[model samples]
Target: MSGTLGIDFGTSNSAAGISVDGTPQLIPLEGDELTMPTAVFFDFESKKMRVGAEASEALLRGDEGRYMRGLKSLLGTRLIRESRMLLGERLDFIDIIARFLHEVKTRAETATGETFTKALSGRPVRFHSEDDAKDAQALVDLKECYARAGFDDVAFMNEPEAAALANRDVMQSGDLGLIVDIGGGTSDFTLFRQKGAQDIDILGSYGVRIGGTDFDRRLSITRVMPQLGMGSPIRHAFGNDTHLAPNGIFNDLATWAKIPFLYGPDTIRAAKDLHKFAVHETRLARLVKVLEEELGHDLAFAVEAGKIMANTPDVENPVIRVGMLKRKAVLPLPAEMMTKKLSGLANQIGEAAEATLAEAQIAPDAVTHLIFVGGSSLMQVVENALTSRLPSAQVHRGAALTAIIDGLALGTTQAF
Candidate 1:
């Protein structure tokens, strides 16, 4: 059996969808889950690899392995071409990504009881943001990845455009809509004019390489990094305390895409050196511990969970608990605090929204409706920024997680 699949290969999560007798529905990739965490783990002891939630589970189970997440964020960067030693074999980042996608393809086929060859993949409007050459190359790289994943032929669609397609029927006739898609690694905007339930015209699109993971980084740097000697003063051997501990390691630890690559000899040596000169040896010691224990992604996940709980209306554990750090430690990050830390990103998102409107030749007041999509769009900061920028427009919410895939499925019905 042959079928067409629409895949949203997100940085932090992924989902696949297909049209079922004229209705678009998501495929259960992980035990009836519509969305699967975009993660991979290579267990050294078991000599086996896992993908999605199983990968996360294996890593959390204290299994000896190399855990990698934020796979989509590697595209358009130099790391995409990089290689790593896994299970005694050299593997490229692209190879890892392709293997993950291949797993998704296989699971999707099994769930649907059909083989899929033609596909429509969702992508951010700008993979590199403002670098046209890199942005174009990102598409080429992703296409190659898809090919390696076993897709006979694949087409790409801007994520926001796909969301717009999925939600077009919700817009009023002749309404001008704006799609704000704040994803895991990028924020995309699309200004479109919907003529009817089935007719939509895209006026313009813009993207920024900042999203939920960026918010997680900001939170980590502000609330958690200090405890790990991020801003601690480094004492020089000349008896002067003028320098600060190197931030490269801390920064990489805070970033989702860079965490996997942070484990190395040079980094370990630097951490040790920092420990010797750190004004607060305890903090630097914690930093070294994290590095030695390979807890970078665990720290990132803690920050992410904190952000989510802080934004949640009623949550008992609002504090970000960093278990890898000193036991019984916590970082107090309330909703207001997370929002404040995310203000700069909010401004950038607003700018991107304004740029989209300008590029579409539509003034802010001219926008008739605003649609929010993607998991990160659930963040209050994103909502406030877009609402403040487009106050005159009515606000609409799409399926936070499945909108893009649903749209991709709908898009598959139309021309590629």
Candidate 2:
């Protein structure tokens, strides 16, 4: 409470903590809960904003409002700075993110009876892995967001490195460990050598712009989008020839960050035009209904839920409950099918981990432990991919949702 506050501002969830007498203690963001969903809702009736679980509740209850998630994925893009009208005010993504962070700061202060003026935040090793300029700008943007959130100064630590710190006890003295921290928008890795009970030597860190949301998007595209006329043929107005529907709308519909933007007038008109074509009118009609009724997020949430259920070992006949889109509409998502759809992405994560070890000039077998963190790390397919690559390493699990914040809270003692 006295020094720096630690914040894990993740794409799917967010948490805050601080060092209390040299021990990391998480602040309860919601009632008796340490972590909160990184979601926001603006109520049209009250003209008030809602954050975290309350926001999700408002969305689920079908309250008339705008709901947004995956805001973290927009940090490096121009859209983050573009203004939109919300609740009678012009606000950009930066302002929206800053407001979420400010809520965190306020809750932490209220919970601990201490104001936090400085912060130590967790960030992916690469916000935009393929674009260096965007990656650099992401950090700058995040810093400004922290400042706007009432933090006078803020420092950042790689998310996987933070997880490594939080799980230092998982490795023996002088043993090498690899931390695989997969979140909603990115997958990060950290290679480190355990030095002592409270010390470690970092070898290297790497990341890729792929994670759980990507899995959801893929599942939606292959399983759900087709039902909404993703690949249906569209007839030309004057000619007998027909072409497959454009992929852009379906792609955006599957993507979490792109859903909110698809509700605009131009996009709806495009969907209607696609619906007007002679090929498979029913499927395209569904697409038009989704746009006009603003049901993209509901579909996205259903897909995400289905993915989680499919990943669970005991669940059978898991299905995406899309009854909101239509009467008793459900998309079957068997575990094997989900695994097959996601195997490529899981392999990509494995490749990134191996690349990290290669960059550090270390052999795969040299790593004695594989510490898995982040919510997405719970997927069996991802674990299988990683374990197959490092067959000799022992696998361990860190606190999936809180490891980064725990480490950031511990790092606060030395951050300043």
TM, every model: 0.96, 0.98
Off by over 4 Å in 1: 314-317
In model 1, the worst 10-residue window by lDDT is 407-416
Model 1 C-alpha lDDT per residue in residues 252-292, reported as the tens digit of each score = 99998888787898899889999988889999999999999
Evaluated with TM-score, which candidate comes out highest? 2
